[model samples]
Target: MEKFKITDLDLYYGTFKALIKVNLTIEANQITAFIGPSGCGKSTLLKSLNRMNDLIEGCRIDGNVLLDGEDIYGNIDVNLLRKRVGMVFQKPNPFPMSIYDNVAYGPRTHGIHSKIKLDEIVETSLRNAAIWDELKDRLKKSALGISGGQQQRLCIARALAVQPEVLLMDEPTSALDPISTSKIEDLISELKERYTIIIVTHNMQQAVRISDKTAFFLLGQVIEYDTTENIFSNPRQKETEDYITGRFG
Candidate 1:
């Protein structure tokens, strides 16, 4: 049930190397978290999952990032790859349009124009994101009008509307308050039943609470990768132990 197999993956932004010899296997329908301090390669590696880093200027990659045994960095249609692997950013970035339009955007972009199908997709996506009950009556309202947590959930709904197999979240709850953060945390746990989730987070507690596996990154390298319990409670690496004990990041 391996969803992704990354082998000797190295990434660079112009002259600076962001990731070095990164190797990991992400399994199907499980939550894997990338944890580290700022400037670590966690986020860079997350973006590389769907080739999102390709948008950056002078960004270069070597080695293989495979999804379902096919190399994503090899000969493949980038757009289709992206559709299969959706992403949500650190901040809640709902489109300026109405809520319904926001959720329907991806399906529409992929040529799902039938209103009947769109309605079903929108409802299912919102429900999957755990925001349908809250936003059901306000579908026509502008997405910007919602609160930060609601907006973040809405963004998740938007990602789900595309029917992606993998969901890549980059510090998705970092911009929210404690209450909002908890809600999104719960949502993330539920999501792993359907999609293989890879989240980059600075919150070790959150990672322990939600992720099945954890990868601790430091200075562009993964110091340790293991089950969440082992990573938090019995980490083999001194750097990981130090990090979990709050001795240093």
Candidate 2:
């Protein structure tokens, strides 16, 4: 099942073209990773999926981005589009509130106010993110007080609370230590069974470890996109081969 289909997409920030003629199909219930060196437009394309680029001034896009066969750049409500496609940033960004409140925030925003319903949503979301057992006792404690990895999982739980169909992660483990990154990697492996995931990572190993498919980008263009095995073992393009072999990014 195709989750998102991007067609002839071009994005620009002022006079600088950030993405050119980008086209890709993201599958449902699988992990798709975008891997490239810094400033290669990997993250730029990620942001375009959920229209986060709209928040930036002078940012413009040409072409179509479809979510579940419907045009996301068309008349779809932006807020509803965001609800269906939640995002976790590069850094762990929990709200300045308790752990329970952090998980409950999205549900509340979507008009879920009953205490019973909210509690169920929070618990289920945390469990889905593989963090309920660790944080159940500290539900009332401040989220910022948690460890970096735990905080990232908490952010994942928060996104899950919104019942999103796709989760977009932007270098979610860049700031975490090895142990924390490992935990997130495991969680992502588990998450693909239920929700479609698209992640932007500079860590090729991480991409290889967790992603089912990989897209290699360069200078605002996708050089290659294929199964993780093919992309890592036998990439077709010399650019992809060179990048994978660490010859050049």
Candidate 3:
């Protein structure tokens, strides 16, 4: 099942064209990776999925981005669209509150006000993100006090609390150490069974390790997209081979 279908997509920031004629289909309950060097429109296309680009002044897009067969750019409510498509940023951005409150924030935003209901959502989301066992005793402690890796998992739990169908992650493990990065990689593996995940990563190994499909982008265009094994071992494009082999990014 396709969770998102993007066709003839073009995106611009002010006068600069950031993406051009992009087309792709993202499958449900699987991990898809976008890999490229800096400023190659990988993040640009990711932001367009849920209209995060709408917040930028003079940002414009031309094309169709469909979520579950409905055009997200149409008359849909932006808030509701966001609820269905949650995002975790490059950095861990937990609220400066208790761990429990951090996980409960999204449900609260959607009018889930009961304390009992919030508690259940908090616990379930934390467990789903594979962080409940580590943080259960510290639920009342400040989220800012945790380790960087734990904080990232907390952010994931927070996103999960909204009951999102898709998770958009932009270099989620970039700032973490090797051990922390490994934990996140494991969590992503577990997460794909329930939620469709789209990630932008500069780490080729990480993409190979976690993603089922890989899309290689260059100069604002997707040069190749295919299964992760095929992309890593036998890409059709010379540019892809060069990039993956460390000849150049």
Candidate 4:
């Protein structure tokens, strides 16, 4: 099933075109990676999925972005759409509060008042993010005290607590150590069973390692998109082949 359908998406910041007309269908409950060099519109396209670009000054979009067959950009509540599609940034940005509070923040803001219910949601989200086992006893500790990787997991837990159907990540492990990066990669594999994931990553190896489908972008356009195996092994586009083979990017 297609969870998202983007058709002829063209984005602009003032007069500069950041993305050209692009069409793609993101499969439900799968990991889709947007791989490209810096400034190729990979991040811009990812932000469009959840309308994150709306926050940027002078940004404009021309096209249709359908979520579950509904046009999200047409008279829809931005807040509600965001709840259905959560986002994690390139950096781990946990709140300067207790770990429990950090995880519970979203549900609380959305009017989950009962302490018992909030507790359960927190635990479930943390477990889903693969951080509960390590931080169960330290739930009251400040999130800032945790390691960078743990902080990122906590951020993931916070996003999950909102019960989003689609999760968007932008270079989620870029700043982490090797071991931490591996853990997050493993978590991405586990997450695809339940939530649709769209990630923008510069790391070709990571994209090849964790994604079910890979999309290659160049000069603000989608050059190719296909199964991970096909993309890495036998891409039909010479540009994709060159990018993947370290010939040029």
Listed in order, each prediction's TM-score against the native is 0.98, 0.98, 0.99, 0.98
Per-residue lDDT value at 245 in model 3: 94
Predictions in order: lDDT: 0.95, 0.95, 0.95, 0.94
Model 3 residue 237 distance off true place after TM-score fit, in angstroms: 0.6
Clashing pairs in 1: none
Candidate 2 worst ten-residue window by lDDT: 240-249
Winner of 1 and 3 under lDDT = 3
lDDT per residue, candidate 4, 14-116, as tens digits? 9999999989999999999999888999999999988999999999999999999999899999988999999998999999999999989999989998999
Cα lDDT tens digits, model 1, 1-249, are 999999998899999999999999999999999998788899999999999999999999999999999999889999999999999999999999999999999999999999999999999999999999999999999999999999999999999999999999999999999999999999999999899999999888899999999999988898899999999989999998888788983
Error of 4 at 10 (Å): 0.4
Give candidate 2 regions above 4 Å deviation: none
TM-score (C-alpha) between model 2 and the true structure: 0.98
Model 2 pairs whose backbones collide: none
**Which is the winner by lDDT between candidate 3 and candidate 4?**
3
Cα RMSD of all models vs. native, in order, equals 0.8, 0.8, 0.8, 0.8
Clashing pairs in 4: none
Model 3 lDDT on a 0 to 1 scale: 0.95
